[model samples]
Target: MIFLLSILTILNYNSNSIEINNAWVRPAGKGMNSALYFELKNSSANSDELFKVSSNAAELVQLHKTVNKNGLMEMKEIKSLKINGNQTIKFAPGGYHVMLIKLKKDLKTGNKIGFKFYFKKAGIIKADAVVKSY
Candidate 1:
């Protein structure tokens, strides 16, 4: 009975938690910088904002969004991202992405990099980004 109660309490405590996954640094060739993609899930009762992103492998990191302008693909800066309660937001290619400017090192396939996420409500979350050829 005690263990069951403890489990319930823990679950309740974490009911408003947020999580991130599948973050990776895109593969790069000579003179080519990289971008990052990931998924953000928020189970909180309120929404959250992803204000900033940072990584050690890149000299600068910022949020970017892809838009169709005059039937052409264009990328622009995103000031923030909204995460509704009990919802997930995905950052992928041809959509919202993390722009990795000024490469510090080469990202090879099977390599993993560390990234830090800045959230308005959830504060900071860190995750390991894997390098893949996807």
Candidate 2:
């Protein structure tokens, strides 16, 4: 499926060996919340940890995960995420995702938002996510 392929691409790289693919953000109005999804691929022999995420488009950007708590879906903030060497991590709906809180401006369809991913080993990896609607 297309969704599976997109996830594969995201897990495909940060530095020379870590690549990000199929990065995107959900469209939202100013002062509203949005979410970013992507695939992070680690191709190096060494493992890496994504400790932080930053984006000027929102007042606050944090790593989050959706969980089923007592049959109710809840979103929780996560401190960090790890991706082993030669592995891939997918940030998707109902899973691990980036929470964009309090948008500074409207994220319309086709708009691009800049992001910086902080990794323990890879350092800061800059990426742009396209605003889209599912």
- Best candidate, lDDT: 2
lDDT of 2 by residue, 1-134 (tens): 99999776556633778788899999999999999999999988778999899999999999999998999999999999989989999999999999999999999999999999999877899999999997
lDDT of every predicted structure (CA atoms): 0.84, 0.92
The TM-scores of all predictions, comma-separated, are 0.84, 0.88
The candidate that wins on TM-score is 2
User: Model 2, poorest ten-residue lDDT window?
Assistant: 6-15
Q: Which sections of candidate 1 miss by over 4 Å?
A: 1-16, 29-31
Error of 2 at 6 (Å): 35
Which pairs of residues collide in candidate 2? 10-39, 10-40, 11-39, 11-40, 11-41, 12-41, 13-18, 13-19, 14-18, 14-19
Q: Cα RMSD (Å) per model? A: 5.6, 9.5
Write the residue-wise lDDT of candidate 1 on 1-134 in tens digits.
99999786556644237798788778875346789999888977677789999988887888999999999999999999888888999999889999988788788999888988898767788899999997
Question: Candidate 2: where is the Cα deviation over 4 Å?
Answer: 1-14
